[model samples]
Target chain A: MKRIIEVKNLYFGYEKNLVLEDVNLDIFEKDFLLIIGPNGGGKTTLLKLILGILKPWKGEINFYDDNISKKIGYVPQFSSFNKNFPISVFNMVLMGTIDSKNFIKKYKKEEIEKTKEILDKLDLYYIKDENINSLSGGLLQRVLIARSLVADPKVLLLDEPTASIDITSQLNLRDFLLELNKKITIVVVTHDPTSFAQIYDHIACVNRRLFYHGRGELDAQLLEKVYGCPVELLGHGIPHTLLKEHI
Target chain B: MLEVLSYKFMQNALMAAFLASIVCGIIGPFIVTRRLVFISGGISHISFGGLGIAYWLGINPLYGATAFSLAAATWIGFSKQDKMSESDLIIGILWAFGMAIGIIFIHLTPGYAPNLMTFLFGNILTVPRFDIFIISILVLVITLSVLIFYKGFVSVALDEEYSKARKLPVRSLNIGLLILIALSIVTLIQVVGIILVIALLTIPVAVAKEFSIHFKKIILISILFGISICLLGLFISYYIEFPSGASIVIIGSILLGVVKGVKKILKMKLNLDETIN
Candidate 1:
């Protein structure tokens, strides 16, 4: 597989304290890489650095000879969206195709057609003209995903893709992602290991540092190491941990 | 109507209202949608410092106000630290300082304040021909800029981070918006005065937002609302001997209440249908 992103000795901080330290990783093209970690583990920070939303204090991130910030499609956490905002699904998706230099021109016919196709592919064609504020959480998530796809990026970086949605929507999103991984690189930051186990080619457990980066199933031993507890895998691929001993 | 048009000052006031409303209508949606109403208020109040400085230096207060407000706008736009609350604190301090300076200049001016109440409460009847010309040109510039940069502006207004990820110039666009707001503040001062300017800038846009979903339509409706309110206010002030600025604002508030009330009724009806079915 071809290497699409390479990060070497990346370091970043907000103030006196460091958030991410001496991080190094390589992402291959068309690879579904799942980054798992607890809250405040710097996973979102790492994604921000890759998207060029924040600059690394030291080291560099290179994307296939171009700046990673320019080409990569980023789906931020849904919490960033204001529920009362009055944007439409079509306009929201059209935002993905916008760049700094082309501020003057309106959306072209080809771009509009492409947005329609992507919305249709995501089963969101019916909600194209609906105000984003009116949609349910699941439908909004699908719209955001469609927006990310409209950019036609080589890599799709999702920050907590299924954080706050229904189970059906979560499964639907996972299935859609599984299919999407066949065409482009997918990097998802999520805590749910069960649903993502089969889809991801590699899992990187992050906790202030990268604990492990390897392939294969997420066995109990690895979960224990990452979560500092014994994990039990229930039916339907849900993870339940036994804390009687700790208590 | 013909007799009213015969007076140059009345004609000038009408022209100023038309020009000011055009700029206000175009920029008003951005102010409301981006939740920058407070920032615009901060800028309007801060322009007082420029007014003071101009009075003290024997220069045009308009120039002073523009310079001060634009400077404050630039500072607010460029200071992108994580804590936005801290930035707002800084804006508050600047706003107070500007007001203080304006008062001091007024005190130092040799004349009997040159009818300061007119500038404070807006005497549209006294608007000059030159002010009308300036307002017209400004409206033209503002409208053209909005037309050319509609997509960028919309993207940034909708979501700044997403726009930045697409490599759009989010910082520059923000600064541009602030400058536009400063200009709008200066243009509006003659019609509504600084104290009531935000009401004129925000109320029509707020009403239009409840009725329209598209940006272009909102702009059109806001312009219509602003012009109609101004004309009605002028007529009422002329016949009833009332304050023009207050009259305009009162009419605008009533219109806003009616629109919001109607929208609520329609939404409730739709919800009733959904529940019943």
Candidate 2:
């Protein structure tokens, strides 16, 4: 597979406290990469660096054949949006269509038509006219996903896709993501490994540093190194026990 | 109310009210949704420095206010690290400093203070035709800008982090918003002085928010509400001893209180119905 991104000796931190240190990773074309890490283990930070939101203090993140901004679509964890905010579901998702230069121009007919198509594909066309504040957690997640996909991005990045979701919806969502994995690249930062157990192309573990546990059976030592503690691999398949912490 | 409208000053005040209400209506939802009420307050108070410098330099007071507020707001938005609280601290100092400069200049002015209370507490009855004409043009400019950049404003207001993720020039948009806030303050200070300028900008939108789920509705309701409050406050102030600026804000507060009370009663009634069912 062709490599799409190259991260070499990356170092990043916030004012005086270092977070990501000497990290390196490669994301290949059409790879559904799962980046799993403990809480506050720099998974989000790594993603931000890759998205070019936060500048790396040292080292470079190189994206092949295109700019990161034009190539990637992003879905944030929880947007602290006011429920009383006056925006329709259609308009909220339409915000993803704007870029730096063409903000003055209205969204074209074809672009808006494409947005509707994506909404329909995600089974969210029924609530397109509804106020965004009225959506439930699952529906909102789907809307955000549709928004990220509307631009036809080469790579889609989601931060904590399974957060606050019910088990049934999580299973449904994984199935949907598996379907999407065939068409485009996806990099998900999540702790819930079981949800993506059968769908993922490769599993990468991250702490302050990264350990790429290449695309095969995930061994125990890699999990131990990533979490900085001992862990157990109990089973596999749907709802697989990727790592059960030894208590 | 008819007799009040007969006078030239009252007519001018009414026109000022019309202009200020429209500008307030358009700008209010953005500031409220973005939760920049405090920043608008900071910018308004800083406009006081402009008033002071205008008096000291023998220039138009509103021009001084416009210059100072625009500078202060742009400076605050542009000169920033990541910490929001620190910027708020700087805004606080600038707010106080502007007021201090205004007071010192007003004290230094040679003549008999030129009725400083009008600028402080807003004597809308004393509004001149020139100020009325200028604010009208400003309202027109504001309306055009708002309509043209409606989507950009919506994106920035609703979800700033997500807008940032989309690479939407979040920094420029933020600074642009500050500039708009500054302009709105300059227009509003004549109708409601430094002490209550933010109230004029925000209170109508606050009530409107509960009723409207769309920005067009919010903006329309806020404008109507602002105009009604302005007219009612003018009439009430004519009869009562309360200052017009303070009275406008007081009326807005009472209306907000009433809205909250009604909402509470409706919620309780809904619960009662659910319980009965």
List candidate 1 segments past 4 Å from native: A65-69, A82-84, A217-247, B81-83, B270-277
For model 1 chain B, where is the 10-residue window of minimal lDDT? B114-123
Question: Candidate 2 residues B1-277, lDDT tens each?
Answer: 4676788888998898888899789999888887788888888888899899898899889899999989988987887538788988888888899899999999999989865887887877778899888777778777888787777778777767666666788788778778878888888889888888899888999989878777889999999999989888887777775688988999999999999899999999999999999
Per-model TM-score, in order, reads: 0.92, 0.90
Worst 10 residues of 2 chain A by lDDT: A228-237
Native contacts kept, each candidate: 0.59, 0.51
The CA lDDT at A184 in model 1 is 83
Candidate 2 — which residues are off by over 4 angstroms?
A66-68, A80-84, A219-231, A234-247, B1-6, B239-241
Query: Per-residue CA lDDT of candidate 1, range A75-134, in tens?
Result: 888877555457778878877778876777877888889998998888888888888888
A49-69, model 2: which lDDT tens digit per residue? 888778899999888856655
* Model 1 clash number: 0
